[model samples]
Target chain A: MSAEAERDAPAGVDGAAPADPWRRGRWPVVTILSVLLVATVAVSFAVGVTAYPPGTIVEVLLAHLTGRPSTVARVDDVTIWLVRMPRIVAAVLVGGALAAAGAAYQALFRNPMVSPDLLGASGGAGVGAALGILLSWGSAGVQLSAFALGLAAVLVTYTVGTLVGRGTESTLTLVLTGIVVSSLCSALISLTKYVADPDDKLPQITFWLLGGLETVTVRGLLPLLVPVLVGLVPLMVLRWRLNVLAFGDEEAASLGVNPRVVKAFVIVGATLMTAASVSAAGMVGWVGLVVPHAARMLVGPDARRAVPVSALLGAIFLLVVDDLVRTVLTTEVPLGILTALVGAPFFLFLLARGRRAWT
Target chain B: MGSIRVRIALATAGAVTAVLVAGCGQAPGSAPEAPESSSAATRVVTDVTGAQVTVPATITRIADAWPAHNEVVQMLGAGDAITATVLIEKTAPWLYVVDPALREAQTVFTNSTANTERLAQARPDVLFTDKSTQIAAKTTELGIPTVQLGFQNYPDLKKMVSTTADVLGPAAQQQAVAYNAYLDDTLGQVRGRTASLPADRRPSVLHVYSLNPLVVDGTGSIIDEWITAAGGRNAAQVTGNVRPVSAEQVAQWNPDVVILASSAFVAADTGAQTLDKLRADPFWSQLPAVRDNRAVINPTGGWHWDRYGIESALQLRWAGKTLHPELFGDVDMLAETRSFYDRFLHHPLTEAEARTMLAAQDPQ
Candidate 1:
């Protein structure tokens, strides 16, 4: 901790007030993270249960890029392009979406502990997926139901909050209503699990709850892209307003930014991203709660910088975890378990260090 | 008017006391009669869970909590004694087709947990459930004799059926002997053909339990036992039941045969739809099994044949025939199914019904 403080002291040592290094070194940090992300993605392509030589991977990529047939066997090409690539892309999208949503949510609520599922998206999506499995609705039906129900849950919470609170401390009322809706969604999920057939549907529901990226296909990846982009674009555009809203609601209102409008946009964008990620990956935890904190620790509490940096860190974290999940054993380890296993300990370390990323 | 009402109440209370005395007298009179009844004759038998339970020698009422064991009881000719059951026509359709009386049985359990009040109302002389310590202890506390039956392989299945028969009576005991003999004979026949095959001759087989999450039955499971008995190696290298694996891992294993378990749901054509979806996937389409059209759905009967059920007897033959048609060319599956169901289940199937069962479709 002292070492980090000393390293960061240079910007303030020359007769100036203690200054945040992020404002000055933002480009360098962003550049290094971007390069690391690209390198991780490239290395992930080469790692799998089915080993392919570096040359063969390059040749396969070149063939796909130039619209030429690969000299490698069709099986190898299919394994690379169809099976592994879809999973990798899904990991990046899901991780990035969850973390960006988390950043937006924490900024909106002015709470460091908040995650993207501050409302009821994950809980609602879980219930929908469990019901779909119990009813034998297939994979696509499950994904669609999950996404719709997730959005519906947030909408219900927002509606209840507005109706009850009117205009008096709506944020607090929203948080209260969100907890209520989240628990209701959890009970519904449990009901679905209870009625599911012990032989078949129970195991499927259990596995789906554990969460993984093994089921992602090229066709399925396309629908996920729409909601994630729709959610992320708005959050990135409204990042500065998120910082403004960090100062209490009355202060933001005096500063000419309508706190209510910014908060609504933030909720909608975060809910959309959270729902889309959960629908695709099935309740992947910790990425949303932990990655934004890591990003803020790296680049200070500026949403404009933290949001994108959190997206990159999350993408890298999940991609590496997924790579380990697939390659470490013949069987697939649930992605949520690995993320928690890595995130929880790292979070405790951060807490022990007592670095206040949030005031 | 108040004095008259008090007199009437006093008279009623005196009559109620007189009737209560008579009821007490009848209780002692009926106490001796209870020992003279059939329930007085009790015998002890050990279940698969190794709990020795005292049961009525001539059991008349039973509560069957294990869905798969419903078929076993029906096959043992004790379907009429099942007063309570966990499964209905929707969950186990074939059981209903075999014994319609089961439709009228009390559904005293849900999600494998029994409602004790309903189960008590059913007045079951004995309770049968899977090997769950909780259920056994709960039912035992209710004074209902609990028999826990479960199996992982063929021998354990035989023990389960035999224990179930022991709880049933002498008639079912005789039937158990016949059923066990039939299983032995089938295994002997299948193993006689498959045992001589060299390692290179046996193809690697993958048993997919579900396709949505790509869960497959790995080694050390009932699926693996049958795959081995039918002269094939399990493609899943891991050791667990119903393991989730990646498509890339499947491609790496590149099994020669892919067997999809029939959907437990009642909806028709789910297996075929899953097969089509697998065919559409570029990763699955290129596998040796898919390329050569060797990927097939496992036949289901009273329960999924590949699972831990009595139909595993049929699965032994079907898997053998599917894998090594050359060696088992003379074996006619329709005749085998017809005879087996006739002798064991006591429900003779027509050629069309047998074909439907073999195709893993619902009885039409």
Candidate 2:
């Protein structure tokens, strides 16, 4: 439309500027992301497998990966295989999914507070999980019910938000819808608690909502891995388009990106990853909201690099926290409590340092 | 951002306070002093939770949702004061015998929310419930005088019974003395009969609940006390009152005698079908108890095992018979049941009632 715009245009029909290729200065961001990712993984393994030492961890992992028989004891094998491994894998998947979802939500709403759980997914998952326990359905059935209910909650949020608009809802409307849906779900959860057998069922319901990977097994890990991979991979791969869309809907459309389509893909992909992770590990909190910010601060706001970096950091963050919970106290600390305790303080420190950048 | 900082600070302070309070709130020093007898004018005054109302002179009516307190009230001769019971355990047989009029008291709701409403409606002068069994803060706030009765283990039962006896006054006090005598006598009989057996010959017993997989009563349970008292070895030595065990773990323990209470066994009709299912299962059949034909199923008693009172003692006696029937070979359990009923239960159980209450034959 302007003379400068015409001059900068890609030499064709009406002089619209072609989309820029991945930013030329992204290499530094990429390097920083790799460093953070590796560091987080290193820290995760360092905290959890403390009994075996770092060298032993490497040897054990190498042996397992290479089809060589492990020298670990049978009891340790059960502990690592049935308990810790599934938990660590689940943490990585959940953390990555949640952080990526948070990033997508923030981009969609153009607000800092938006996270995957903001859409009532966690509350719905908790209620469904509580119901599953009350019904005395064994382990697998409980996880399945939680995931189904989480997806249903997301679907409800999306539908209600859409009804408030012509085709697509704005970030504010979407958030409002999520709050209402979550409140409704929470009320139902309370009602369930009221009727539940106090001696057994209520305790189970409370424990599920508190969130833990205490009983996660390798068999449980298999089903969640598929959806997490499917959901997280494509979103990270398409980060370039995601970055453009973050510039605001009108600007993104003027630049030839279909804002509606991108939003849908990101939401669905992120929701699937979140639902899968929750079904396996319950409603672990804070990593999604905090990890993306940490990633952004470490490597600037380039989605291509930030997505993977956030995923790695999230996995690493949760693993270390979980290990702390198991080893630090005689009783396992609830994952949600630890996350808030650790994440909230770290976030505040980050905000203090990056006050100018944030503004 | 500032709000987040505030939340973090507040949560940190609150969590620290909670941990500190939890730590400090142990030991008898932290608990309120027990209410003194009205008959004694020199009774020491103490801080009371809202539910602990200091009556001017007399306590006419009382309601107890916690059946553990029933023996205490009965022992104090305050049967007339009890207007309602939260739930009844017919398996004890003695509760009916001790006070036939107790059966006529109104039933209070068991589910928590309704229980609260029922407490208000009952409006008794005093309410007895255990800290574990009821919401103390809310109940106290509802303007009812509440007392905490301990039931952490079997010994706690004697303490609760004695405490309630003191509060209930005279007539119920006589019942308490008789009940205690009965307990000592019954326990004495079992102990005397089995004392001659060598330690090596002592039956190792395993109690299983098919309803909740791997749940077995352990150290704090009356079963543990009964087994030890009856000269049998408890198989659940390393576990807690309610333990999570895998089917593999149960088989590996290979208890000398396997027993299932009616409460623990799934409420299915076909005994042969149940036995066959157990025998056919790869995991369950490997148990030595199963192979030796030592597994027995106690008849259904409803939610009777939920409390540890005289009912618990009776169940223990029944468990002792099931575990080592040969120790008392000439002891006719049917005749023993009726006699025990007449002496402890006070009410005569009809032949039909007696048959239905203890009819689950040995599954092995």
Candidate 3:
């Protein structure tokens, strides 16, 4: 590591760091986004399994919400409330959680590419889901096992990470531990997959590995949503502290921020969000990795602007991808495949042209 | 920074709008109106997924996403129409001789994913598959009509044959009707002979699908259906199509009849002990089925009876004959099997060939 360069001492002691990069237009963007998120979700309910008209979907959803009896066709009501509604809700929750957590990790690790799964939540959840399939436990068991183990994997990583370092190297050490744990979980998943029955169990395992929101149900979403909200609330509250955390620990403390305590809270929040997202919808990669980059590109490096926008952007991106998935073919393509296909090109484009937004 | 951020957001908005338009442009357009009658040159069959898919009323050229469905189509007498197939040579090499026309059919798929472009070049009137979402999607994208074949049980297999026969048009209808009648007659013979047996008199059968992990066929599986038809209760009490249990659990089940139904490759790759390979192991001789000399290998022709294939109806006979040899003592299985090939499959088997086809013992 290079020694710290001598810097010009603050001339006025508090000159606000040269007006901070083009004054992020956060709320205007967010307020517009909040409306977009609602509209996108409302639109998603009309177009899955079978397409219903928008007016009919709106009527059915409103009726279901108000406890007013639905007069729409049985298929329309069932499609909207029973299947598509829960699925879109899952997409929103998972998408929002991944983006929010991704922003947190990018801030905490001070690495732009740090995804929510940097801590091995996806890997652990995969192994758990595979084990559930092997045991012939039903879908509930699979989701529960995945959720439980995903949280466990990260907690173990965090606990193990703190052991290897006391102060200066803690954050980097934690990332290293996460990579190691994720690799371990991935290897275990491979082992389980190897022994699984190729005819039946293997296909189920392969499907889960590919990751999707196609299997989301109302029952499955309830348990996942609570933890995801709980995880996200803390991150949204601590998002401002992310800017302080971005300056290495010594600098953070000098500026009256306890880096370790704040880092722990942020990691826990991110972990919870990631674990919940993964447990709800298997291993959907790239959303956490790339959505934040796009968000950061749009709103500079300030966590207060970027994190919430990341959440909104992630939700919109997933909704559109989900739309493409349901409509593109007769069957649901794994969202992971679509995201990677979409994310990689967008990433290169961001690198090529959006470098200024990162400042 | 401000200007670039606006461009980034605008670019994103533009891309999203482009995708939405392109995506909506392909919204299944309008589902093809299914023809009213089979005589209308296109017959609409509601597939297992409950989607009404139109198939050619006169199926002259066919292709399947997987070779497993090739055997089913062949049995339904539509094998002549197959212009392309997947892995038929390596998998069921017998198909090349049985249906010499298969030699000319292109290999359009080997594993799960089909080469959609090559498949389209094959110019099949209809695509046959045993139901796959990926295949279904690809066929729809390529505007190829597809028929999804499914067999829930022995009874469902009959229905599948009849349905496929109807789809294949008039020429195959005779074979479908004849096969259905044969199915009824064969099962009727088994039921007539075994219907009088008390519940306790019927043997407890265990279908060992794999031996290392000790995976067994449970309820909802085709093996379970065959066992039930053959007049034995499945010993492994479980739910789902199949379940992987322990050797310890196998011992506890104390199955009177253990039928092995795994291949050498599966056994080797999974490091699972096949019934044939377990002769030297200490645990092999300890089981109740082994003690009674009731351990037997499942018969395979084209493919195993357990898999959804044409040989499944014959599997019923084999299961019944093996379980209760006393009742079916007069039925010459070898001669009857040869006749089945000669009459239904249109390929007569010599004595040596029939014996090879009937062989269940591990050559290993």
TM-score of chain B of each: 0.88, 0.71, 0.84
Q: TM-scores across all candidates?
A: 0.52, 0.49, 0.59
Arranged by DockQ with the best first, the candidates are 3, 2, 1
Candidate 3 segments whose C-alpha is farther than 4 A from its true place: A1-104, A108-114, A118-205, A211-245, A248-359, B1-13, B16-23, B26-40, B84-88, B100-123, B133-138, B264-276, B360-364
Tens digits of lDDT, candidate 1, A109-138? 888888898899998899888887777674
Query: Model 3: C-alpha RMSD to truth?
Result: 12.1
**Once superposed on the true structure, which residue ranges of model 1 sit more than 4 Å away at CA?**
A1-22, A167-169, B1-364
Residue-level lDDT of model 2, residues B105-224, one tens digit each, is 655533221133334445566677643222343345344455656554555555556556545545545666777677667778877887788989788887765535667766656667
Best by DockQ: 3
Q: lDDT at B87 for candidate 1?
A: 83
Comparing 1 with 2 on TM-score, the higher-scoring candidate is 1
lDDT of each: 0.76, 0.60, 0.70
A68: Cα error in model 2, Å: 3.3
Model 1 scores a TM of 0.52
Q: Pick out the ten consecutive residues of candidate 2 chain A with the lowest summed lDDT.
A: A9-18
Better of 2 and 3 by TM-score: 3
